[model samples]
Target: MFHSIYIAGAEAHSGKSIIVLGMMEMLKAMTPKVGFFRPVVKQEDGSDPLIHLISNRYQLPFQADELYGCTLETTRKMIGEGKIDEWVKLILAKYRHIQEQCDIVVCAGTDFAGANTGLEVDLNARLANHFGCLYMPVIKGHDRSASDIADSVRMLEDHLATHQHCEILAAFINRVPNNQTDNLKALLEGSPFPFYILPERQALGRTTIGEIARELDLKTIYGTRQSLTHEVASYKVAAMQVQDFLEHLENCSLVITPGDRSDIILGCIAAESSDTYPRIAGIILSGDQEPAPQIQKLLKGVKPMRLPILHSPHDTFTTALKVNNVEGRILPSDERKIAVALGMMESYVDMQQLRGLIASDHAKRVTPLMFEYELIQRAKKQIKHIVLPEGEDERILRAAEILSLRQVVKLSILGEEEKVRSKASHLGLKLRDIQIINPRTSELRKEFAEVYTELRSHKCMTLKAACDIMTDVSYFGTMMVHLGYADGMVSGAINTTQHTIRPAFEIIKTKPNCNLVSSVFFMCLEDKVLVYGDCAVNPNPNAEQLADIAVTSSDTARMFGVEPRTALLSYSSGSSGKGTDVEKVREATKLSQSRRPELKIDGPIQYDAAVDPEVGRSKMPNSAVAGQATVLVFPDLNTGNNTYKAVQRSANAVAVGPVLQGLNKPVNDLSRGCTVADIVNTVVITAIQAQEVKA
Candidate 1:
């Protein structure tokens, strides 16, 4: 199976040819047979230099016509004012040949050969459809106007959507100006595609051992970083015969020899003194075979030469090509992108976030409705009654007993005293330092009546009704938060989001100036976290509502140690296309910026523009929020829900929320799909939020 991917520019001058060659040189370590297939080459005057490089340098077997493949010009002419059937067949044939032998194929495209309507074959679309290869569009990193770039991306997207049947796995923005990249990045963030912004670096595919050593803090006994230059060449093969190998070693940084072939190793050293190439960095021996003793000793001594040897089990041709695929290699640029991705993922998630994500499904990771109860839990810098709704349940009783021992919280249970004790005893559930209340017989304290009467009048409720509602756990929970009876309240195991919040809202309400309540779902992945908002409320919010959502989400993000870079997502970017959805995102962005002038915000961006630098550059070059958007605010619930799910299923992103927000107190809902860990995490998050509120 192909282990890596490589994409070249659309035009010959688009820099596809050199990049392919450069990738081949650097991917020398992964495998020897880097598959070479030009899906569409227009030149009729020349034999493909790439084919010769692949066959001769890597010693890859090739039938003459197979190596040359189909020249796209004849096909383009034949299809355009002519028949396309034969051309399609010819294209498919070449694809099979390239796909068969190589572990990775550097797919090349015709500059603009198929762009005309007379021949309706777009080079990018045809290549993507016929070969089923990952699409990696390469663009020039020149000082091109943003309008031109945006137009180009639109054309590409339109072509791909119509004819291509593959993902734009990644993109490469090459030759970008140094000082202008930041400005370019801002523009890219508002696009609707996925891409990487590759800065000018030493070598494309091949990385210096020194750079890796420095990054990993590895002890490098061989190869000095200072002595190294930026250019690294790629070869398709380790050696042809022992004879052709020596001449090929000229000017090569490393002689990538096959592990099982001692002849190639012997040949490389013999040619070392030839002053043709730079000193070999070392040998990246292909395959898992052990080198002969004499050859190993010879390699060890080459006088003052620290010939570092690396190994991979694949054939020399395959390993060599992979070593040169810059796209797969983690460069410094990629590290930054990955780091940002990790940070976004981290900030987007929390315990409540996780609960909201997993709460909706029935495939449980653990028991349903699991909860934590404490006897003397701390609240508001003082110990107060912490109610256990399921007072007679053994789990609650046992939790109460342990919490009491620890003086964690003042425990209050609602049940007949005899029943509570009997259940605890029968289940061996300890209950110590606990207080019990019975609705039928418990005396109403003076303060309870006074506070209840005051709240009753405030809410326009009858005194009797108010007192009765006050005894209900949900109602009492809200009162606990409001009346300082308890620092916080937690009770939603058997309730819905509304049930959990209604009592709280009715009694506590929100503090002054808090307009609309919102929710944030923190999607946590193994390596990162993500914050999704309004997933559980305001199903189809207007632009104004969305703006509010963005503000609340940003605040929530900051509360969780994340620096928010918000992306307002929509199907269209800017005012280029018309849609209520796009308008919502655009307005939300405008409102958010106006509301919080200091925030780093951008919007009317697609998901790709929000995260992929290359996509952002191509589609929205003037955006400050593109490519690097850490927080994504969807246009509406449908968009948010579907997009989040698609990303979760397709990109392996873990969706973790609908963490309820905008409540007077920290009361979140549990998805019926929650796991025990999800429950635990939510409780912890709620506790943290509650603690902050109390402070």
Candidate 2:
């Protein structure tokens, strides 16, 4: 078991940063203070983006000079001068400086990108032994066979661990094909330490707009600091006329045209505005020229454009080549890609269990960060089709880009295709392969209207009226959920909650087993995540209805890894007070346990007694759910809603839902004031729920 780890690659381009970044993410969740260091970086002056990415993303308080001992160039020169001992001392001092301030520090070995492989390997082995840290060797599995990998691992163990006295933590084999994992595992069956196999992730190699700008030193003209995170899928030189250029547009394409070509510039904007063409990642104005004054004025006169407009001094050809060759990695500015990289670590490694082996003192609880990271990975494994009704809004479009980029779920946006496309273009959004539909003019409208009429015919509904109502985006999106068109629907960004869920109630309805629908907010606090129940749906549930809420909320808690030690919350602690509310909670607790015999519940519990260990023990010593309550069930909406909001604001917690439960199919409503991040999370949860429905 080791708190700190040193990662060394078997060869150049082993892509060991994936393991480094992944380890840092896991350490951040498991421990309070985590630090990162690089023994020998490529750049001696500490201008490495990986260093900055870790410092900024994790909010480390280390300066650039404090991050690394020396550059690879410096190491080579020092070794030639017979100063290897001095170099070791320098690196050990720097590593200790960081280790002193952190609970654990993750250090990266020399970038084998272009270093002297044998010398760097020796240095890493020596440093690991000196630091008394765990040595983690990463191998590239792209073209290597089972026997090849096994031989390499055996050699490393024999050299580093056997001769150099370095503690071998684990071996990582990255970029392997799915079919090769088993053969590789079989070949290395007798390894001393566990060997982890990670498949190749294509997105890990793709560069973003910010990386291109930094690599080429392009001057930004239009995009904000945030839009710079857009990933460039492809690039093209727009040397043709406006009509021809419009005809040749591509999805997420970076357009490189002459700066003075006002016709092409306006044509690109027009393409974005019409939704008839592909989405543009950004535009590059080349040849050392600027847009004409009139064209610039026209650009300002138009509605705010998000398609990043940049200027490059080089000619179109040079700029295009530079853009294409820009290397991609997880940048501090791009949290979405960081999520993707972290997802790799989460899916392949049993990080929680691994922590027990490495850090025995680590608290056996799920942090909010770990929960959110695991949530995204879960949704990606069972990709479900989800529909968004408020497709024209900027927040919705922005979230759509992230969802599409991550490939977490299949998405359909309900709106006129042209309008949604125009919105997407204006936002510089790269919504690849997302289905767009116009509810009013869709081929399924008649079918949806007929289904609606038959379902509501008992209420004296007419076909014409049903057709008119079907034109509403909310109703259309919900109908998609009812039919096999979409697995789930998320809305209420611009609409009221009633407008968003009325159609679900009228059409999809509740499940056959569950008579009531309830809601729970996964309140992500500072350290742990807790589930708050009946916060958005039920107003004043009776004992039976409240009992149902407790049962469903417990399942929801367990679904998200919050083990349910349910507390039926009221104003009093178990049998200590007399009130109708307390009585109702006590009755509900009994009713819940009777319905689900395996439930752990105690009712008439005060909030403090239910959460504080000392208070819970003092007040309800014999009760099972006195403390350690992961799920809190509120007796009424007024209490549940107010308490959740108070904790969210006062304690700085992230309230993830009001996630709807008890539906035959999954249909979730969003708060009207939700942000782009909220929309993204809600959609992810809805997709997971849709998978549950199928199950």
Candidate 3:
């Protein structure tokens, strides 16, 4: 229910700013009134282009000094005075002010050590309590080891856990090598927190073939695939006084030889005779010697393989070392990995790619709401009053302006009014349909005092303090929906699921008879939208919990136009194994059937049998859910996360979510690593949920 969100990082230069800006850009497309903020600023040169660009492009408003939680002087004195809470209070006041102005607020954070060191726990607690902001830790995209990233995430999570009392939305691993993607995904699969695998920016891949050749000091004799990158492995030399040639040609991709050495002719013949390895680039003959007839014949035969032989004329030692150094040298005509990553990202992380990457089998189904949309089209009811939370940047603000102008949704951004307008202006964005609201101003009304008091009665603080806390967008969001102001609320851009939902629970409450809130992700592909549930919320749900999860997921599937044939998955199948794991799935299946007798549910089934028709037939004859289980329910979080990732990376399936379920109203959170398409899908899902709630 949070109307304003704050995007924070573990440290500065951790790409926190970029992530916040990107998310803002995506959110703005759907709703207007999106605002940006930097509640606390420490280092103020006032001329940093990045800050300037953010200020102008996002139309954000912040005195550089107010952006940081504590001043250097405040920090310097806190060490001597031990009064961190005082500084935190100052920070909370500013955040509350920002929250009161806009429908959505994007609050950027200071560094890890400096801000936290001043009042450490007290400051964070105040920030989290006051704003109910979801703290997402962003890691730098360096060549750090996997363990290093994990340790860093662990440290951030531990720190935030102590102060925020919320979930780590997701850990973003940025700028990773393409080859190392699978390894990193696997490594983080078992992590306690969500891990988003982001590729290194492609802007770094601008190297051309000529550049690479020059760097390697090699002549590009023949090849227009001049763009073909040479990731050279260890170069090997087969110096046979002619006899040792056989062993030398053993493991080399490129061969280096003395041009005058006619003794190796026999070795060349032997190498040509073996079909073991394919010939790649041709040989480099040093010392510039013309080959003898026998050598010439051998070279001609090898030339048919299309290997380009080059005459380096350099000494044997120099040539050997020279070829060995070409592994990652960027060619002049060729693009570097960085550039390729960028090019790929331009297309790869786009809506289509994101949809494709996370697409599942159920994505093909259409929701029942298509009729509702048609009805709305017929009725011509204007769609308005769209609300978004805080922590938005320039890009998002521009999108919000567009959506507003296009009349897509009534845009509402949560943050400070002046700051929101200022950021929009800086971005050259015109938020025509957007309206700004500070949650603090509206949430402190006398009507909400009773509910606010009841919700925060047990926690630390008095009625006034609790009232201030309720003014936070998190609590205000619930009030907005309760009071029937905005048609729907979209949050979790910068907040955790809990932070996003806490206010909803305290005020809006759940639909009658609904218990055990769950989650589902709509994994969209090119033309499909698969439903994955309970992958996000439940950790180790037992039979009852599993049954509840299955039923809810099935309903979600049906809502999306998918026929809900539920598959309760496990490691073993058809009673092949005996353990609590298998028993739990079985019991859940029975419970699901009893609870919803009409649901086509199957359990204790292998993934293959659940998804593959052939496997389903072979394993269980005449099974109803065999090979057509559109909704898959895993035994535990570990299994669900690992399997989803493996399928996404290895089988090339697109996985959209951990879309949250079981809320009184529509509210979902985003992974720090989510693409724009993911945001779009989550938004659509939220829209649908909102429709249902309204009905």
Candidate 4:
């Protein structure tokens, strides 16, 4: 089943909350753990009444504060300051946390109550698209005609599909008049999308006296406060005489009159206690007037009837007009209305069709944000020790703090212990659970130096030279990984790539059946993660080396949960062009296919043809890996390096690695200008790689 569903609305008072409650009720019936999330709410501190109602009624595990992402003011400020991407990242992180705890989450969109509802709708669409959520738009039909409701539904679906690119599961037409239900359904029968129509019920729309009191700034004159939950089906201006007004009284009607109108007040209250009259919701004594003292004493005795009596400052006509336009809300104490809403939804909506739509779309592709989230989650499953050589660097220390706090990896930093601690303190970072080591003064230094000399004696390394080299943090950190003291090593934030990887090349060496060490960057584009190979290593390789890079890159992609569709990138598509580069790519493709026939690989394809489905079909129609290539093997280092950087800077993609492949033990490098996030991601990937090695 889907982990979540988004219920959105096209306009205000769309009755979207009914659908949310209905979906929650439906899911709760089937599963024990269901969650509710509201990404944007109107209240400043997120004290939203709907969130509270749902939480209290369902007894949800999460508190009301945890159910919403942020208030509208915060969202507006973030958008004004151009921090929308940061906002989205925060929302996704919060959503992933909830998803981890619940079997399913019902995410409701904004209420469309503010002046910027157009922007609100667009934001809702953007969130649904970003999260890969299934969205259902609720079209309001309160004052709209049947044909107008149909047009609204169609336009909303078009906007969601074409503009926002949202995967719409269905469309709900809410608050339609009972008489127009058949016509609305008939009008929408041929809709390409699924349509559900819920007829308008007065019980769901009736305002209460408490709501009126709050809106008009009224005072409680008499009776029980709990009786405010009673619904006002209709309102009447009691300007007429008692006999005539009694004839105008309807079931659960609120009477509006001056408090001095003793006859009307006494008659309504008496009728409320009589079997011959319909029950009155309440009486609103307008004009800020009070009854005579004798009548007040009479009301004190009648207070036992448990009826609500409110007093408003406005006149009777004005109070009646205000009551006429008051839109009801589902309050926490309004159980009767909620039950009616649930019954209406169960009666009108097709539960089986909705259940089918709720089934998880297994074919839905993963987004870059989701891929990053999964990487952290997977790394946290099995913690591995990763050594960082440049511990004194502020960026390294910051990254170590994050990794340490998240507990994604066990970190050991190689440097002067006090210097590392002082640097971290200066940076205001608390590096908890991170081990600090001084390579020269450490007990393991002697053992690592002796082992290094023995391993390099064939190249005429002396013990003094080996011990001196081991004092260098890079050599010491690599020796830690080589000797199985640490599972992996990440360096080069403050050193050259050669200084970082040279120790690994000499000591850890390549894995068996691997001829050379190649690197691939996990380029996280907007929609998916693509592996770009030999981007930071192997300056130029012949056909065999290129083939090895392709195969190794494919394996690396698979290890990270990405399906391998290898694309041997060149200037040509299939057999379209001839050049030295194209010939090498084609030969490499042949070699890789021969070695690993299980892999889906296509050769000599242009970048656009490899990534765009239409272009790929036009160029290479029958190739399996033409358009959906997840692993793109560049012909040389120059091309791969330039392409990955260009995409990273221009497209705003997150490049997560220069992750070295074909190594027995994991050792990854970073750019000199890498950020703290870069170091953290590299460390996480390295930990995951170590897990694979151990397995």
Candidate 5:
């Protein structure tokens, strides 16, 4: 069964809350634990009314902080920074934490109450797709024609299909008039998606006297609090005589009259007590004029079965006008309305179909977008401090701003304090909370230099030479990671790859079982993330070193949530050509499979045969790893580097790392032309790596 499902709105006020409330009740009936999440709430401070209602009513164990993902302002900032993927990561992190405690989760989309609603629609679709949840859109049909309702549903279906690539489990047209239900059903009969039509109920949409009094700033003069939720069927002005006014009274009618009209008030109260007359909803006394003491005494005497009497300063006409416009909301105190809504949903919606949809299996396909999202989420689970050596670079500063905003990792930047701050200010980037350190003047410089000397003393390095080396930001940043001041280091945005990784080699060195460090780029193509190895480190390796790279690269792929199916890329398909390169690749393939017997690996294969299913079937029909490889180990760095760049440019892919593996600690390098996103991704990867090392 699916672990979660998403409820989205086709438009504002689509009665999505009814579906959510009903689904929660339904799921809770089957499972003892169910979670509710609102990924984007319009309210500041992250409070949502629906969350409070569901959590409290169901006695969900989730705290208030756990129920909301973020506020509108925070969501807008993330979207503006092209960090929606990162935002999704944050949401998923929170959700996974919540899911651990529950059997299923119901994630609701945005309320569409603020600006940029169009953007919010796209965001909801992305969130649903990322969560791999069943998406059900609720369409409001009140005050809309049958044709208009059909058009809206069709348009929403097309948007989700074309833009989001999400399959709708089902949809609902809520609040349609009873007369239009059959027409709307017939119009949607041929839809590829399943849909249901719910007839309008005035009770479901009616505002109570207490609600009106609160909205119009009226004071309740006499009534039991329980009577506040009574539905108002209609409103009438009592300016005429009491006898004539009684003729116009309807069931649940709210009477508006001058406060001094004791006869009209007492007559309505008496009629409510008499079975011959229709029950009145309540009485609204207008113009702030109270009845005489005798009337007050009579009202006090009737306090045992008090009617809801409200007093407003506005005249009867103005009070009636305001009451006509009052719209009701489902408050926590209103259990009767909540029960009505739940009953309506359970009666109209197909619970069996919904349960089947929720139980259906979703194919596990990790798109590149999902892989990137998972990366940030994994990094945030155990946040580690990462130091950026090239802090003065604008890309680095911008990345720092995002990292700080998301709280993905603790950041320390190594540069001259004034220069870094000035450059950040010039670029309109905020780095106020990020740690800025001038390597030469930092308080930890002496300590870091001493540690560096101790680690490199075997090479006959003097203390003075070590101090001089520590003055360089790259060396200082790497030393911070080595000395446990920071968890990892990411640099090379303005420096060469060597300048970044060399300090790590001199101090942190390689892991005990590893001989050399290699690198891989998580080439995020359209559908999947392919790990390209030795792409930034190691120009060439012999058969044994190549096998080691394959093993390490496979571990790296799995570390970032990609299942590793190792493919050794060569110039020729299996046994099709003979050359020194082909021979090396074949030997490396044998060596890798032997070393890591658990890993599925195939080699001496052309790129086309390795990645394309049809080509692999024709070339290497019996290979387990052919055409389904997630980790591609190249024969040399030249092939891997050029191929990744070519594919990145051609396919518009996101190449996340040249993340160094086989290291004792995590230190990563970035390309000189990398964007802020690229830098942020590398830093996050480094943090995850550091977390693994600590583990």
Candidate 6:
């Protein structure tokens, strides 16, 4: 039997596309041969937008036309002629054609087009029952109370399960209000089947200037066309005084006015350039006018800005309504919107548990995407508090919002509470649940200083000196981890590596019997994850230190579910060449082998032989790790750091570390030039490491 799932919306504009997009992503990550099929569609409308979107986004090999089983017109005609069974047979045959080449198929249910609500619901239920597919009804929850949403979903579930006898897997409630989310989810959690709630985010529905321009066939008259990607959160008619208009504007406002209004035009430019005013998404020059010659010349004299000035043939009011009503779709090119949708789904939904209930066997290979998902899921299993020392930075605040929303960790950020809060607010991020601790005003300052004074008594540290040192955010955050108030700490987004980890070194120290502290990057290539050691710490090390780093890195790999096959990297493969570096690697390999006999360790191997199976077989035919090394140990810091970076840049690999090993407490450092995603990933890894320490 074919394995498939049907995503059906209970009403029009139910926001089920988010669930479809998320499901497609999960399926693609877990399996290779996943198919997207639409059983019926409007003939006049051609292929569905979602089908086009999935095909383009995922780069599906098949044609979009082949994905459809029947047209809405054909289905209605066949049903009127009492050939419903015949229509079902034809649809089933087409579905089987698609499924024959796939492990699993996901059929998007009928869009509420050209049919009444009851008709669409019946059609969806019939299709699911006929195809033996798992049914997931998506109910619209916009402007509804928690009790109303729950009641609607329950009635639908009963209709599908008790009346239609459909295999209902889950009910997804979309557009839930922020306050009602918890109550709605709690109500659904008591049901036998699973459920997912997507909270309301109207910003995602806002159309960008590019979309509006395309819809109205408008022409760009000034500034860059690239600025058309800005989403118009709200629109305004700029027909008043500059100061009064500025006060009326909100964030991401799309302005519409007569193009000859040079005062308003110049006012918008000044407002956007200055941080004191809201950002205008774009300007629609209505009444078929461009800026006057003098204004255009003046605009050319100033520096170029990312503001689009479009000339609209219609009047101001018409232009405003048309642009405001233009709906935004999750187009293949819109990565920002896609990220937000997927992030929301991942935050609210239990991906792993949902997969267990719905999907069966998938690809066994461990891909980088799958590995990252596993990291987030694993961290969520035992939530641990992790402190971010560089909390004032925008990247740190953005990552905190993601981690907080995902419920991946218990986060406490160290900075001035008001400063962090204001920064988060300016970025339009919500860190309401995240604890912001000001190092100078926190209650733990005295206790932390006392502990530090005792720990640093040999260095002549007094209570006053300790108290002064505790005021540093890094020191305060590290102390939280060391004192067991927080489980771990992640810093260095803005600070130097030394500033971030020095506190950990002085207070947390090393684990038992581990003298050297080194670092490794979980270099996630396209299909596999490899460990590269001593890339961030230990500029140069002797044989013993190198061996300890290797063993410690191996333990870390195994701790994260990667089987450790340690390879000592050098310029030569096996013993074919001899030099100081090769000799050092050979000695380190021997020491590591003796220390951890169970782990597969090979030495003096070139990067090629350590990774490529063919080269490995030619060079070292007898070694277990030569062909399939998951961990590589560098001879010195200079070689390790440059090589990891070169590979990362040239190969487009996601280098997710310099994860420090041999630490008594779990403290990891971020790259100064890391992205928001990097910070989030590092925080997740830190939380997982903290779980090990607590265990």
lDDT (10s digit) by residue, model 3, range 278-339: 33224556766656776666666553233334556578898777655532322223322322
Q: What tens-digit string does per-residue lDDT give for candidate 5 at 1-695?
A: 56588898877878788788878776764455568888877665434668767877777787778887787778878878999788999888887788788767899998886667567678888888887777888889999989899999888888888988986788988999788888888888878767878778776688877678766878888877667766678899999999999999998789999999988998988987766787788898888888788988888888455468888898877888889887766655565566567656656777767777675553354555456555665786788999998877877887787677556789999888888886664343557568998999888878887887788788887888988888999899888888788999999899998898888898889998789899999987756679999888888899999999999999998988888988999989888879898999999999989988999988988888888899889899999888888889888988888999899999998788889999999999888988877887889899889989954
- lDDT, each prediction: 0.56, 0.84, 0.58, 0.83, 0.82, 0.84
What tens-digit string does per-residue lDDT give for candidate 4 at 1-695? Answer: 56478888888888898898888777664455678888877775545767877888777788666788887788878988999899888787777777788867888998876787677778888888776678888888887789988887777777777888888888888899777888888888888768888888776777877777765668988855557777888888889899999998998888889989999988987888766887788899988798889988888876355668898888887887888877787776654566567656766777657777786533244555456656765787788999999987878887787676555789999888878886664333557789999998999978998999999999999888988998999999999999889999999999999999999999999988889899999988756789999999899999999999999999999999889999999999998889788999999999999999999988989999899999999999999988889999999999999999999999998899999999899999999999977898899899999999954
- Predictions: Cα RMSD each: 25.0, 4.8, 28.7, 23.1, 23.5, 4.6
Best by TM-score: 6
Candidate 3: misplaced stretches above 4 Å?
1-385, 394-399, 443-446, 454-462, 651-653
TM-score of 4: 0.53
User: For candidate 1, lDDT tens digit of each residue in 1-695?
Assistant: 34334365643334444444444433332334556666555554434444544445444566535654466667656667566657767776876776777655666665454446312325455555656666666777656655555456566666666665546655556555566567666767766555445444323334544333333233333333322222235443665787666556534355566677888766555554434434454565666565788776776676544344555566667666665643313232222222222222222223233223222432211111111111001221344455544464444554455445334456667667888876654332346667777644546433454576776685676676666665666666566566665555555555566776777676667645567777777664333455777777667888887888888888777765456888888887666868766776777888889998888888888888877899988888988778877678877787777777776778675454556666666665655555434443454455545665643
Worst 10 residues of 3 by lDDT: 371-380
Candidates sorted by lDDT, best first = 6, 2, 4, 5, 3, 1
The TM-score measured for candidate 5 stands at 0.53
Higher-TM-score candidate of 2 and 6: 6
Better of 4 and 6 by lDDT: 6
Error of 1 at 221 (Å): 61
How much is 65 displaced in model 4, in angstroms?
Answer: 17
Candidate 4 off by > 4 Å:
1-359
